[model samples]
Target: MDEKVVRYKKNSNDIHVLPPSPYTEVPKPNVRREKLSVENEETIQTKKKLEKTKKNFLFDPRRKTFLGRSSLNWARLAAFYTVFYFCLGMFFVILLYVFALILDREVPTYYNKDSTMAVRTTATVVGMGFRPQPMVDDSLIRVSNDLYEQKRIASSLRLYRDVYLIQKTDAKAEPCTELDPASELVPGTACSFSWFDIVSTQDHPCSDNNMYGFKHEEPCVLVKLNKVYGWTPTKGPLPIHIQGLRNIHNNKSIAKPDVYITCDGTNPSDRDAQTEMVYYSLEKPSGSSKYGVIPNYYFPYRNARDHVQPFVLVQFKNLPLHRLISITCRAWSPGIEHETRGMRGMVAFQLYRSQVAEKLIKDDN
Candidate 1:
């Protein structure tokens, strides 16, 4: 029976499962998926924390922080800038006080004749200005095609009218009987400017009838010297013969120096074309007319209250219609120096007659 049982067991186990093979494969852990799940959880937590921080930034004032800065931090920053600017302002004030100490209050510290600095640097000794300059910020005079254009013509006349009225109404001014070239002008004396003599007649032009010579195509330009305090014109080198004649002619009386004015056309080509152009008072002999452009002794312009500007009237007899003419006027005196760059002691301007009226008339047809 033992032998039979042994045989049955052997036969039954004939298809026996062998022990597990050494080459059998085992399942691997999903490490990549586990790592991704851990990263996602951490990202979610970080996002939640950022949102909470943003909410605190917006709503939580008691948190004592705003956009990563506290209110106390901002206040300290502002206070720092305030103190910095205050110190800067104090420094500027100190600089200004030091500058004031170096300068004179009444007189110019660096511009006077005795100034060593002024001697080293080229200074403007004279200034020239003109009136009846209709356009703002401009010195040129433009006349319209039509003489009676009220807007254009009246604008120029209005300035002259105001000046005329002022001169007429001022009772304190002494009657300027003559603009003597040989006379010495007293500094404080207010001489009469014969406004009527130049602008009163139709023959000479510059009258109400002629609209100050604008209607007649003979416009008047009034030139004035800028005021310089404590400065006087020097006697220029006079011609020897003229000086000898004056010395011989006037024995006892001192020979008075004259401020001569000359107006020339800037265009060398067109200079001959406008030969009729002349200075009204200068056309006559010296001391004959009281209305010279620049009179003798019209210097050392005092304050505005006590002094009137020394002015000359320049009249153009005829101008080329609808054309531009560049003209320059110069003041010659020993005390004044001509400057090439600026309008000192000299002024240049263009005279233009508008062809717009003619263009408009042609366009209408």
Candidate 2:
């Protein structure tokens, strides 16, 4: 055993390494290889899943722009109705203008009438600047049984003539003397026919000594009628008489006499006495000379009060009147005709205004 052991010292490069044995396969890198393969496969599968998720979440620009246009179209439709409502507001403005033109035209009517019988009347509405004609209404004609009497007399008498008288011419006076008896003409001696000579004819008979008697017998009958045309030969005031004479008289003086009339049966001749004939003088309000007589007193009973109704008012006019005070009134009677009398029942009388009658008086003095 000792003799078989031989020791060999190998050089650094001289030792040849034997190749791995083919029968004893190389030790496979089993765990690491398996791990590397599994890791690579898992990475590829995760990348595939990320690509699918990105495709599902995709948004298109064209589809978003289309939706924005649809919203603008809806906004435009809403604005159109607002403009249409503003345009429809003009219809009310035209209607108000038409109503203002109808209120600017009108007329006034007045009816005035006077009658003796009962008749219904109405006023005809006429146009401006013309008087309205009254119409008869037959529904209100009835007379009340109130009868009265009224008398009227002349207030004044006027005359135009020269005065004369019958007298003899004095022989001792101048031959051509003037015999003026309140006459404008002078009678001379050369005057052949005297007033007596011409009036003594048979045609003008002065047989009656009565001053009021008239005989138309002479051509100078007009002269005789003047002297005899006075009132009854009463001792009171003589009636006014005027004569026309061209010749002059010897002693008689011609004078003008004042005339008068009375409603109460009395004669007044003095210049101061004319006041008695005046029933009412505008100067005095009440007294003996003042007659407070209303002109409408002659109306029937029911009609009498009609003039006195409260609706009537009298209005005075004119600054200064001669002898009468003028007053205006508004009448309100319906004037309906009565069934029985076939006449109007009452007349309407309305007084507009009144004042003191003295405003119209003028003193003769």
Q: TM-scores of the models, in the given order?
A: 0.62, 0.12
Alpha-carbon local distance difference test for all models: 0.59, 0.24
Quickly count the clashes in candidate 1. Answer: 4
Name model 1 segments beyond 4 Å from true: 1-60, 64-124, 147-154, 160-165, 168-194, 197-204, 239-255, 282-293, 354-365
Over all chains combined, what TM-score does candidate 2 have? 0.12
Q: Lowest lDDT 10-mer window, candidate 1? A: 1-10
What lDDT does model 2 reach? 0.24
In candidate 2, position 43 carries an lDDT of 96
Q: Across residues 1-365, which tens digit of lDDT does each residue of candidate 1 receive?
A: 11111223454646443455556665679999999999999999999999998988765677768776788987999899999999999999999999989886545645546655246335436667666776658867876546445247656756655664245455444544335321244434455555554444555555556665577666766666666665555544643333453354432322444565666777885576554654555335222222244555544444324345555677776687767788777776555666668566788877765545677667655
The residue ranges of model 2 lying beyond 4 angstroms of the native Cα positions read 1-13, 17-25, 31-48, 51-365
